[model samples]
Target: MWVCPGEADPELVRAGVALIADERGSVLVDAGQSPSHAREIQAALLAAGLPAPRWLVYTHHHWDHVWGACAWPDVEIVGHASGADLLRAEADRPWSVRYLREEVLRNRRLGPSFRARALAVDSWEELRILPPTRVFTDEVELPTGVLLRHVGGRHAPDSTVVVVPDSEVMLLGDSWYPPPAHLRTPADEPDLALVGRLLDDTIGWYVSSHSAPMTLDDARRAIAG
Candidate 1:
């Protein structure tokens, strides 16, 4: 329950769960979609029932990973300085009209498949959730002893990539938004090519906002082939 499907995005919304370790309390890599979806993320934390979250981080300002942040219990929210602005906007509007149309169709026809999509778009305007108590430009450390670095100018204005070498895992929000069919599709299409370059240089063992952890070799091959 602690690391199943995050609420950040819906369509192929596979979740990347908590990277639990004995040395440190659980450091939730990212909060999911709306407050409701965040509750879903919390379900996993609840399920773990030990080493409760000491803090939470955001991959970026994307509505899916942020709007749901209000559900967190006033934990320290970490991110690039620009991330809060993005989240503020998210709680102000529904997704683009095109996105909503897709959501309606996916919900009505796609059945259970729409769960992720709904999580990403549902209650967006009403929730207005994201509020990062802490902000940083480049990097920050978690009480659990994980180091999160803000990989700049790759995915979005305030894109963040969280790394915890002790866990030997890195949480990449939508930078590598997994395609519905398991393709290396960039969630931020405009920065797709650029982001790929950053991933090449910085990441090793990567996890998507919605998929399982991917090894460096797998990530490179997914990009090249």
Candidate 2:
């Protein structure tokens, strides 16, 4: 597995992207925030002698997670059905500094902080939104023995988790995060019970979207706390 850690800042927001490979090509996790970011990941994979990815899977439909889909045109994109719908809706909307600034002012959900991150790109006009080409309901298991399961959360209703039972690792992809303060969207607490059920004795390493990977016990305590 190869991972490109995410970065969070007032001026930029980038979620992590990962690759799980086997003798039969590879499967990518998130797509990052822009074409440049995606290229960086690709270059790293090339340098590491990893197989080129055949599929890109989204953990959710958030901008920071799926905006980089434009860069991986050759790879098939997969995501939750609701996430695809959200991305399709976003694809229909205009993306520009002026538009984003206006939305930041008018749309409470798109706050000023988000605007800053969105405008951090070198060229806003070059930004292109691509929804997932393939979507699934419930869960799907990749040939790599990776499991993608929907575990809706306040952060994103279409949130998904990737489980590698053999490796005993799971990518949480912000599924355990609280709803963004910008959105102020009313939501229930995170479903720690469901998360708990998934984190059986087999799983040891847990990766959250923004933070470094943590031990299974640490993950459980963090989620419960």
Candidate 3:
């Protein structure tokens, strides 16, 4: 009963678009904002017949995406090979350094946003950086009754997404958001080109980690966009 649907994190609803599931021992994609926020996601999953999660999948190292991952059982978690570095970098840069500026104190315009992140953990070092149980340079597959493809160059250098071919479903990280055509910048813009080629080479539907779901044709069109 692995549920993969669009969800929101109460703390930062605007930035949250989660993917949670429970096929065998709870495998949640993106453990979410913090432990409290993850509990909220857990409640939702429970209400929908899914249990608390024991494992997780990090789409990238965005603080809003994978912070509370530690709260989950340190089962066989997975992500891109570069994911660990990205997570480690989370604690490297100051909370204020996210927005490049003359100096940390010189930046005053980012007050509200600053406060939100000021509370963030300055170093992911104590957090273990959550290594993937199986890291791959190019691709990896999940044998849980589906073929999961770990893709790079969608959101971050360590960005990744999965696809269940038989179900015609794709768990696109931040590579794409459908039905909306404004914010489509990716770590690898050329990835857009590859998306079209992927769909043409195969037949399936696509679902983003954040926005609405799309079909194979939709993926091709969006890739072309």
RMSD of each: 6.2, 2.2, 5.7
TM-score of predicted structure 1: 0.68
User: In candidate 2, residue 37 scores what lDDT?
Assistant: 80
Question: Each candidate: what lDDT?
Answer: 0.61, 0.81, 0.55
Candidate 2, residues 1-225: lDDT per residue as tens digits? 878888856357778888888886689999978777888888898899998889899999988887777888688888999988889898898877777778777876667556655655667666788888888999999877889999887789999999877678899898877776575556656557766766867888888778788898886797678
Q: Comparing candidate 2 with candidate 3, which one achieves the higher lDDT? A: 2
lDDT per residue, candidate 3, 1-225, as tens digits?
Answer: 344454444223223434434353545667665555556666777687666655566766665567667656655677777877666666565433454333335655534334444344444343433556666666665544434455555446666666555455656666542211222434324456546545634546666655667777776677667
lDDT: which candidate is best?
2
Structural RMSD, model 2: 2.2
What stretches of model 2 exceed 4 Å from their correct place?
Answer: 8-11, 185-194
Q: Output the lDDT of residue 192, model 1.
A: 43
**Cα lDDT tens digits for candidate 1, 84-167:** 777666556555446656765756544344455554555545455665778988788777667777765544677777776665
Clashes of each: 12, 0, 1
| Rank order (by lDDT, best first) | 2, 1, 3
Q: How accurate is candidate 1 locally (lDDT)?
A: 0.61
**Per-model TM-score on C-alpha atoms:** 0.68, 0.90, 0.68
